[model samples]
Each structure stands twice: as structure tokens, then as C-alpha cells.
Target: MVDAAITPPSDVDTLAAGGEHCSAHEATGHHGYAGDAQALQNRLRRIEGQVRGIQRLIDEDTYCIDVLTQVSAVKSALDRVAMLLLEDHLSHCVVGAAEAAATSGDATEVNEKVREAAVAIERLVKS
Candidate 1:
């Protein structure tokens, strides 16, 4: 996924000013959205609907147990989404970064990607 348009590091730093980029992937195109984009969108839509339903139930003063059940379902659905995203990230971005590091002495990029993923996992666990 190397980008021919990629500038030198300093040039990139200047060019990318005001853009959201913390990882080398932004320039290298090494990390990207992977696998079944439509499916991911569908899953997210379902989860979004589920959340709205929960809000409706709360508004209508649904029974405590029923609300709790919906809450549990939402949590499970969200967990599944997280796992799916994690799988894609591991199989694609993380692996790509590591391979690039091994072949091209870009271990810093791999380390950065891993650290980013670790932080995401930590946030998910906290949630």
C-alpha cells in the first residue's frame, strides 16, 4: 500500500498540518479499512438502532428487568463489533506493520501501530 505521492518526512509533517494523523500509516497507506466495509456499516447501523430502541424504552419507563436485558444485548452486540474490528486490525494492519518492519527496518512504525491498538483494547476493556 505504498503511496507514490508520499513526501519526505519533513515535507509530510508540513503538508499534513491541521490533519488528523498520528501514525505513519497515513503517509505509507500501510493501515487501512479492511474486509467487508458494507457488512461493517450494516452491523453499526443495527447497533445504532438498538441503542435508539433502548433510549425509547427508557423514555417509556419500561420495566427494569426488560431495560437491563436490552442493555445486555447492546453490550454483547458492541463486543462482537469490537472483536470483528480487532480481528481485521490484527490480520491486516498489525501484520502489515510487523512485516514491513522485518523487511525494511521500520520497527518504529510497527511499535507505533501496536501501541495504538493496545490503547484501543484498553479503552474497550474499560468500556
Candidate 2:
């Protein structure tokens, strides 16, 4: 049985999932939401439906290839959302941290921020 709950990763969720709540924002500057949150939500909602549809295909005993097609679509949709969030984070959090480190002459803060970004990218790549 497919578990039906689908939660999109928000800024808080993503940050915490990676580690801390993006405390390095001070290095980059006061980072905040950098994209259209509403649009992201809408896209996630659609992806959630796609997930459900794949489940339905399985329940209906649909052809294997057809179900796989839906699975592929769902994966692609989720990847898009992840990319959007990643782009937003880079623009806001990462950039802000870099600026903050520069302004404060605290190179370690920049290192920390880069490490965080690297971890995030690693997670994305692994998945």
C-alpha cells in the first residue's frame, strides 16, 4: 500500500532536514524566501496528485509500463521542485552568507556555508 501523505520541503523544512535552520544566513546576509512560495506550493500540490495517481494505477492493476510512466513523471515533478528550492536557497541563503563573511572578514563562516550547500547538493545527487 502506498502511503498517501506528500509534504513539500519548505525553507524551514529543508534547512532542518539538512541540519540547522540555516544559521549561516548571517554570513550571506539576512536571507529569506527568494521565490514565489505560492507557485511552489501549487506545483507541489500537482506533484502530490501525480503521486496519488501512481498509487491508483497500481491499485487498478494497470500495465507495468503505464504505472512506471506515472512513477517517472512523479519523480521528475519532485526533482523540479527540489531544483526550484535549491535555486532559491543559493540565491538567498548562500549568497547572503558569502556577503556576510566578506563584510565581517570571517572566512570560517563562508566555509560553513559552503559546507552546508555541499551537503544539500550531496543529498540531491544521492537521491
Candidate 3:
């Protein structure tokens, strides 16, 4: 279904207006989440544990509602992680684009950055 198709990209790199790499930070192997990388990793690990627990619940023939409840919890957890990532992207990547545009006198990069963020946000809302 639609929800099943909604998955986060492994890498959020995209080309700019002129076919140039737009994500300067990602180009250099530095992500917006670099500072909170460890914390994010820890959260993802915990989510993985939760997912395994859900599998165990199903294996044990747990009530359907109980399984669904756990599933909702996991979804909520993922949403939190996504939000953190979005915040990092806006603060670092989008702002960097704006700064670069200030000197280059071309808003192409900034516009593309904003469009990317909007698309990401729309996907999140749909999910």
C-alpha cells in the first residue's frame, strides 16, 4: 500500500538546478546529523529492539490489538527520528544553501533546497 512505499531514503543527496550536487555537507561525507549521530544511532537501535519484540509478539500469538499497539509505538518512534533529521537538514543544508546563494547571486540552490525539504515534509505527512 501507500504506507508500505513510504520509506526514508538511505541518502538524501539530490542534484541542483544545473546538475551539480546540491548537498555540500553530504558531498564531504558530513551529514547534518553529525553532531547527534550517536544519539540517533542509539534511538534506531532501540527501535530495532522494539521491532524484534513485535515479531516475538506475533510468534507468540499475541492479541491482534496488542500487536497493533506495539506497531503504533514503533511508528511514533520513527516519526521522532525523522523529525530530528528534518530539523538538522533545515538548519544545516537549507541554511547553507541560502548562505551560498547570498554570495553567488543565484537562488537556484536555495530554491532547490527548499523544494526538497517541502517534498520530504509532504511525504512525512502522508506517511
Candidate 4:
């Protein structure tokens, strides 16, 4: 398990300053929809198949290193999916919330979301 208490930078401008948004979708209309959702699903399906293959390997008494290698691959695949989702959240939801908070003079909501994102990223990194 990963630690979930890390606080993110409180300054919204600093938080929004530098990162490049790398999604393929156009920025205007595709706010909430993740463009890579289908690809992420496909990757997860492949990972599931890989897991089944690991089970078969175990049933066949396959070597330990081989099983470990496949497990690592599955972990990497899951990490990729997580990263995609995180990017989507940062670009869309987090940014929008921060904008709303700034306009409404309610920075607490933005800070909370930033903390949440920080914790999520920390977990992903630890995993």
C-alpha cells in the first residue's frame, strides 16, 4: 500500500504552469471523454489474457522466472492504464475544478482535488 497524505502545491498557477497535455483528442469538445479509453480497455484485456497464461504456466509447473516476468509485464500494463487515467483527470477535471474555484473564490475545493490527485499519483508511483 502507498501513503495517501502528501499535500500538493497550493498555488493553482504554479500547479497549472508547466505540464504538457498529451491527449490526442481536440481540446474543445472532448472534455470528459477519455480518448484512449478503448485502447486502455484493450490493453487491460491483453493483461487479463496474460494473467490466464500465468495460471496455465503454473498448472504446467513452468519456471519461476518466467512467471515473474509475465507478472512484471502485467504490472507495467496496469501502470500504463493508470497513467492514462491520471492524465485525463489532470487535464480535464482538475483543471476545470481549479478554474471554477478561482472564479468562485473557493480555493479549498481546488486544494482538496490537488491533494487527492497527489495521493493517487503517489500510490501509482509506489505500486
Candidate 5:
């Protein structure tokens, strides 16, 4: 259960110095998963249920191996979600940046986008 005293950050709270940003949605205000936001939410809801199930298993004194197996399932589900987001980011943000750069005769945005993707990929791999 979440602590009532602990407030989660709002979108404005999470903003950097520049401005507020929605996850997977940058300056253009386009979410990479805009077309499938509901689907994504559903997947996340399922994951949440899985987590609750894990908690119940522990409460019931489930076998160590069984608990670990559920934990692994959760991890894999999360990884799949991450991969989907990454794919959408590549298809939307990176491609959009490249297209815009081509017209503006500037590679800065494209380079930045690529670098961001590389960093995200690295982090995912490390995890």
C-alpha cells in the first residue's frame, strides 16, 4: 500500500528547467505511444495485479522458488513494456527528429535523439 503522507510528483513537478514534459512526449506534445496509450495502461494494470499477487503469495508463505519465479515473470513483463516504449520512441521521436533535421540542415536534434536512444538502450541492457 502506498503511504498517504508521501505525495507523488505531478507532471509540472517532474519538469526540468526548460518546461514540463510527458513521458515519451517531448516538445511536440506527441506521445510516442499516443496511438496505444490505453493498451499500455492495460498492460501496466496487469503488471500491477501480478505484483499484488506476489504480495499475497508472500503473505501466504509461498515457497521460495515459487515466489522467485513470480518475481522473474514480473521482471520479464516489465522488460517487454520497456521494449515496447523504446520501439515507439524510435519510430516516433527519433524518426521525427531525423526528418526535421533533414529539412533544417541541422543534425543536432537528430544526434541528440540518437544519443538519448543509445543511453536508454544501454540502461535497459544493464538492467
Candidate 6:
């Protein structure tokens, strides 16, 4: 297996090539569905507020451990958000790409997506 920490040159090239083949198909729609978008936005808003709170905590000279605890919470929350996004991507993007490739008899694109997903999962595990 390839080392997930080190992205291959070909993978970099494929990604840099505008990701055109990968970008053209997605179920989330460019703007995403109303419900999912709104939910994500709300989470982001809460995260933003958390960040502001951290700032205020610093300004008020709050206890170090309390601030660090809040920071850890923020990290965990952000990780949850990332997991959600990854779930969405797999369900919508990866599935659709696989189906399309199967129908077209072109497995290369879908294989790349699978590799990308594997790398992502590895990174998540490491983190």
C-alpha cells in the first residue's frame, strides 16, 4: 500500500489538472441541497461563535486549562464536521462516480476516487 502521508506525484498531477474529470460529477449540486447546506452552515456558525468565545476567553485572561478544553472541543467539533463531509462525499460523489464508470466501462476515474478516499481515511486515522 502507498504511504498515505505522502501523496504520489501522479496523484498531485491528477489533482492539479483542475480535477476536471472528478469535479464534473457530484450529487450535492453546486450549491448543495437546502437541508444539508443549512445544517452545515449552522454547524459552521456555531464553530465561528466558539472561536469568538476563545478570543474573549483570552482577552479576559481566563484559566489556561479552561481555554485549552474549549480548544479541544472546537477541534473535536471540526473533526465531526469533516466526518460529515466525508460521508456525504462518499455517498454522493464516490457512489455516483462508480456507477457512471461501471456504465461507461471506464473504471480509471472511479479507481482514482477510491484511492483518494483511502488516503483520506488514512489521514483521518492518523489525526
Top of the candidates by TM-score: 3
Candidate 2 lDDT over residue span 64-101, tens digit each: 99999888888898888888877777776666656665
Which segments of candidate 6 are over 4 A away from where they belong? 1-35, 122-127
TM-score of each: 0.71, 0.74, 0.79, 0.70, 0.78, 0.74
**Displacement of the residue 60 alpha carbon in candidate 2, Å:** 0.9
TM-score of 6: 0.74
What residue pairs are clashing in model 1?
none
- Ordering by TM-score: 3, 5, 2, 6, 1, 4
lDDT scores of the candidates, listed in order: 0.66, 0.66, 0.77, 0.67, 0.71, 0.67
Candidate 1 positional error at 34, Å: 3.6
Instruction: Please list all clashing residue pairs in model 3, or write none if there are none.
Output: none
Clashing pairs in model 5? none
How many pairs of residues collide in each model? 0, 5, 0, 0, 0, 0
Worst 10 residues of 2 by lDDT: 1-10
Residue-level lDDT tens digits of model 3 in 1-127: 0111222334444433233344567455676788999999999999999999999999999999999999999999999999998898788887777777676766666766667677678779989
Best-to-worst lDDT order:
3, 5, 4, 6, 1, 2
* Model 4, runs deviating above 4 Å: 1-33
Report the lDDT tens digits of candidate 1 across residue range 1-127.
Answer: 3321222232222332222333335545543444467788898899899999999999999999999999999899989888887777666666676677666765666655555566667668879
- Runs of candidate 5 exceeding 4 Å displacement: 1-28
Question: RMSDs, each prediction?
Answer: 8.2, 11.4, 9.1, 9.6, 11.6, 5.5
Name the top lDDT candidate. Answer: 3
